[model samples]
Target chain A: MIGIKELRAGDSLPEVRLNPVTRLDLIKYAGASGDFNPIHTIDAEAEQAGLPGIIAHGMWTMGNLAKLFTPYLEQGFIREYAIRFRGMVFLGDVVTLKAVLKDLQDQELTFEVAAVNHDGQDVLKGSVVFSAELPDL
Target chain B: MLKDSIGKRSEKVRNTIERGAVRKFAEAIGDPAPIFIDEAAGAESVYKRNIAPPTFPVTFDAGVIPELDLPSKGLIHGEQIYTYVRPLLVGETVYCWMEVKDYYERSGKMGRMGFLVMTKYGENANGELLFTEERIVIISEAVRKGMGA
Candidate 1:
């Protein structure tokens, strides 16, 4: 867990390497998120839609990106999150999550975050603002 | 045209933040955070109860604006932003709705693309605002042609 006092701009958090993307994972995500888009689950549906195969939901990757802040939950909560879908995450592709503290002000820490696929391509990129109580100066 | 939906808003929908669904969502994302799943652990946390993950609101039914009439296929989720007032607690009832903030078109390698910008809102039972989700949905040329727009 990261403490508010220990946080500094430019410090990098521990990298999180997720298991390869799987069809079952997407199915579970579809059920949980209520986004039953077939392109994210059924191969036939994806092919019919002109995609090579099933793809992961953008929200799924965005949700997992929050895992990087799990340890810091005790210190603060995520106040804001924003991301742009840069590329597609295909089946069997492993994703890596990274975040670097970008700013610290008034108990809010801003982090530059990105999810990179196995090919070193960014599938998603964004920023997160975490709010915590800073020690009185 | 899609531009007419710029100020359109949808009917408000009520959603209950269920513990089971929260657990499932947390698990699906591969996050085994005890605060999200384990009740005993949650009781020990600062919030003093289980809390939903930041992205959990995606499960809520933010009512749709009919005029958008977006194509069902090949719609790409271009961007998303969520601003929260606080973490949503388990078992809480929140009302959600959506509004079309803007719309426009741009040409890219994929040909003409329509960018639909909308905001989804979640409020407490008392009608106090809690969070707002801003998203951009991209309708590609292929999807537009399919819709014959």
Candidate 2:
């Protein structure tokens, strides 16, 4: 993990990957999120709704992206963060989340983040605003 | 049917941020960030207590006075945007409010689809702001038709 001072404007954060989104993963999410939308939990219902079996909740992918920034969250100085869902994700799709330093101020840093699937299709994209003291630098 | 809610904002609903729920959320997202799950580590970390990941606001709803009584089925989550005031702390009570900000339509590969843009927020018990999550829900024509069923 790089310290805030070690990060350059174009530094890339280590990517987080989740392979083969499974049906059980969606079930756990449905339970944890309290979002029991059948499109995400039941395979047959998803097909009835014109989807390719059960789909991943958009928040699931976004939450994976947050995992990439979990180190920062541990230190507790994140000032702002936001994301936009750009594509759909289905069961069995491998997902990857990435981020790059966008800017740096006296004590703050911003980064553009993305989550993409196996075909390089976007699932989510967003940015975060964080300001914190250098801890291990 | 949702068009009627274009600018309707719901009354604020209050809820407490619980540590157990925060840990469940962390595990569900597969994020093992110590500050979000380990109280011991958190006690030594910056916040001195477990905190939630930025996207954890998805679980904080008591009930929204929905202005749009649209069909719940077949409505997909199109997009979501979250802006933070600071990281939310576990066991902190906060007030949440929601509103349908816009209603529009566009051509979809399937057919006509409606977009309902809604914004929700969390504020500390003292009335201080915490975070805002603006979400877009897409209702396909199939969903529109099923509303009467």
Candidate 3:
């Protein structure tokens, strides 16, 4: 668990390594997100679209990246999240999520984050800003 | 032309954040945080209610712009950014809409690719901004050719 008080700019959050991506996972995500893009679920459709095989929805990978902050919700909420898809995530690829605290100012803490595949290639890269205190609405 | 659609805004679509949908979204992402699924835990949390995950806004209906004319298949999600005023609470009704920010084409190793940049907004019933999501969708030359546009 992350202790917001003790966190420093150089600290890296505990890494989370997900199991191999599976078809069922994609299907569930597609249904939940209402992103019924066939390229993410049907192998034949992906091949027809010129892809090697069914690929994971970019949002699926992006959603899972938020897990890094799940254990520290009590401290604050994620105020900003930005990410760029650098490479494709295919079925059976294990993605590792990592984040390093980049700066802390007032109630906001920023971290540089990335998701890398089993082969050590970054599939996504970006930064997330966590607000340590919820401001008055 | 795709560039002509730049600055076009879509119609506002209203969405209710339901508990069941939130639960399903949490389950789909494999995040079983009690704050997201268990009522008791939520009651004890700082928010005093179950709050949706930061990425949960993806489920909202961001109204589309007809001018995009994107091919149904082969469109790639290239980038995404979310700026939140606060975490969305379950049971709140949000009005969602989108605007085409920009569009351009570039040549990459794979071939020619078109980048469509759009920003989606979510607001409360009172019309106060809740969050804004900016995304870049990539259209490959192949898909464009397939469309024969």
In candidate 1, position B12 carries an lDDT of 94
DockQ list for all candidates: 0.60, 0.51, 0.80
lDDT of 2 by residue, B65-147 (tens): 55467665767777778877677778888899887889898997989888889888788878877788888888888778777
Better of 2 and 3 by DockQ: 3
For model 2 the local lDDT of residue B23 reads 85
lDDT by residue for model 1 (A40-127), tens: 9999999998889999999999999999998877777888999999999999999999999999898788999999999999999999
Highest DockQ: give the candidate number: 3
Runs off by more than 4 Å, candidate 2: A74-76, A133-137, B107-112, B145-149
* True C-alpha contacts between chains kept, each model in order: 0.81, 0.64, 0.80
Candidate 1: deviation at residue A61, Å? 0.6
Which residue pairs show collisions in model 2?
A: none
What TM-scores does chain A show, candidate by candidate in order? Answer: 0.94, 0.90, 0.96
* Model 3 per-residue lDDT tens digits across residues A24-129: 9999999989989999999899999889999998888988998898888878889999999999999999999999999999889999999999999999999999
Determine which window of 10 residues in candidate 3 chain B has minimal summed lDDT.
B66-75
DockQ of 3: 0.80
Docking class of 2: medium
What is the number of residue pairs that collide in model 3? 0
Model 1 regions lying over 4 Å from their true place:
A134-137
